[model samples]
Target: MPLTARHPARGLLDATQDDLGCGWAWDQVHNVTPRADLSCTYCQHRMHAKRSVAGLRYFAHDPGGPQCSLGLETMEHRLLKLQLATAIRGAGHQADLEVRGPEGRWRADVLATTGSGRRMAWEAQMSSITADDARRRTATLAADCVVVCWVFVEGHRPWMPYVPAIRVRPPADRADPWRVITGLFRWTGLHWEPVQVLLDDFVAWTLNEQVVPRRFSPPRDYWVGGWTAPQYLAQAARRRL
Candidate 1:
């Protein structure tokens, strides 16, 4: 299920918004009767508005439709995309969900674009992926000038230290927000250490170009990031950029 759908006359419609950008009340599409004219943004199939027990709003594919690529994504993956997109917009950047590369070379879970034209793909890789496969996919996006960072919500990932990725603690309840558990690091002159930050703050800083990835030396294969602000970098005097 997704939070966005297409309305023939109103353009793109967002279930998460109280105001559909066109001054239409969110209820115009949500209610006991709900609108029947909505369609999927990806497959152009008919869609229906739905609200989860948790009160989250989204659009679900109508029954018996061709399997849409977006419809195939897991619930966790879709929620994470919602989180990433909201954060990117909160940071004053643009976030496009389920973005496809030219000729379908690659599909990004969430494609974030900065005001300066730089783009980054945030991939929520909750499912298992071989280290080599992850590297290959990351390389594919990079070849298209789109950098990627894999994200894992569970803690048992063996590829954690081998890819450009981060571990986030997913919300346990509606009141909890995602907390960045790792993936962002700071060089302490002698070694690197993880930095604790709220997901929203980290996403914002990253989109603003204040945080950056630091690739490890020849012996290591993974990449992590640190803030570029003077205070954060002052401790890494001995580490070369």
Candidate 2:
């Protein structure tokens, strides 16, 4: 599957000869030794005449080729955890990474203990809450012990709010709806707000929020919960680069 024809829901880039009807032709086109810059002469001539290349090379080559990057398999929530941990550590706080909890497991991306020795659990959320997980974590973690934060990234402005639990809608249709949802809650000031978000949007939200804050204060307790493995890996890779 070429990038242009790929399904929105699936990241697969089909390069099979059978599907492309070019058998070994594709290999020749893609595998040829590197050239400084390949340009279609015919298309260039037509462009000089101000014409379109709609059907000229439709079968000759795929304009949108395969995406060779093997992206990470982590979710935005997990990336947020990493970011929060990074931020907390930068803030000069005594932080721990990935702590266990009774309900399931609490991996504090960044754990911090206040000067007074008070514990604070911070989570970066970019997805909606399922009724069950929300109830369990809320019950297991003390309100005062936990301080849930969310980073919503959208057009122009982005917001980071420290709150309790974040309300996320079902994952459907949207790619990354977290930014939109978080934008909606900017004025509320409450940590937990019901919002619709997609996976990628949430990742962006977390990254923007964590990078800035972590530079100042590393978190005491950190957890992430809304993206897939690939997403998380990409984020981690970007940070490393």
- Computed on alpha carbons, the lDDT of every model, listed in order, comes to 0.76, 0.34
Q: In candidate 2, residue 203 scores what lDDT? A: 34
Cα lDDT tens digits, model 1, 46-112, are 9887887867778889999988866776778778888988898889887876677988889887889
lDDT for position 213 in model 1 = 64
Clashing pairs in 1: none
Poorest lDDT segment (10 consecutive residues) of candidate 2: 42-51
Alpha-carbon deviation at 184 in model 1, angstroms: 1.5
Model 2: per-residue Cα lDDT over 1-241, one tens digit each: 0011222232222222223222323333343455112222112111101111321111122244333211111244444444444455445454443444545344332345655564555544344545455445543566446543333223221122222333334334434332224322211232223345543444334333431212112354323323223333345445555
Report lDDT (Cα) of residue 190, candidate 2.
25
- Tell me how far the alpha carbon of residue 34 in candidate 2 is from the true structure, in angstroms, after superposition: 38
In model 2, which runs have C-alpha deviations exceeding 4 angstroms? 1-78, 102-109, 125-129, 150-241
Worst 10 residues of 1 by lDDT: 223-232
The C-alpha local distance difference test score for the whole of candidate 1 amounts to 0.76
Task: Identify the leading candidate in terms of lDDT.
Answer: 1
